[model samples]
Target: MNNVKSLNKWANAHTYLPVDVLRMALGVFLFMKGVYFVSNIQYLVDLISPIEKIGGGMFLLHYIAPAHLVGGILIFFGLLTRWAIIAQLPILICAIIINFMGFMHHQNLLLALLSLGVCVFFLIYGSGKNSADYFFKMEQ
Candidate 1:
């Protein structure tokens, strides 16, 4: 759409090296989280257990880790950065909601909130100059 094109244009003009670094850091964090979930399946199970009563919880159990893994990689390389962030949005939102519904860990709540905020920022900011998306765009 026109809006997206305009936003991309704006992001490219505004982007700098530090923003690109932040995006990479975010990607690493999410990827590690995916690895954590995959390694400790039981922890992930317990994470969603309280919300099981909300329905569709089992689906989340299966969905979160893989989404994080794939989405994290896509985001790290800045390949389809917005799309990757869009995919991550639901998981991050659920993470925040889940924290409130259960035994509250301030650390987790804060981390989730911070990560969600950054994700939202990057969603608008795009990948910046030093990214696969920019490089690929140049090639085309």
Candidate 2:
């Protein structure tokens, strides 16, 4: 379809090596952060308590770790990168909200803001030429 061609063109257009490097870096950062969350379950639980009070509950708390883990891996490999980023958005947004509410440390707010910015960038530009998305798209 013409639309698919258009999308592929747009996705491949104007990609730079730096962008891909940054994307991979973001992926690593997210993956490590996710691992941190899993390793520090008590800390994660405590951090999400306020969010839990805001109707997120135990379910939200419990799922956040694995979502980050899986999403990070997907992003890292550039496999289904957009979907991975989309999946992480809800948790990231919620974190931003919670952090801004003065319930978290100032440094946490900064980290959340930075993470949100990078995620938004990748969401819009996708994975670039160095990614699995690019390889698959090329094969198509």
Q: lDDT for each of the candidates? A: 0.89, 0.80
| RMSD vs true structure, all candidates | 0.9, 2.1
For residue 71, what is the lDDT in candidate 2?
Answer: 86
Candidate 2 minimal-lDDT segment of 10 residues = 1-10
User: How close is every model to the real structure, measured as TM-score?
Assistant: 0.96, 0.88
Q: Write the per-residue lDDT of candidate 2 for residues 11-113, one digit (tens) a residue.
A: 6787888888788887888888889988988888877777665685778767788888888888888888878988888888888887766476888878878
Clash pairs (backbone) in predicted model 2 = none
Task: Show the lowest summed lDDT stretch of 10 residues, model 1.
Answer: 1-10
Residue pairs clashing in model 1 are: none
Residue-pair clashes per candidate, as listed?
A: 0, 0
Q: Give the TM-score of candidate 1.
A: 0.96
Give the local distance difference test score of model 2.
0.80
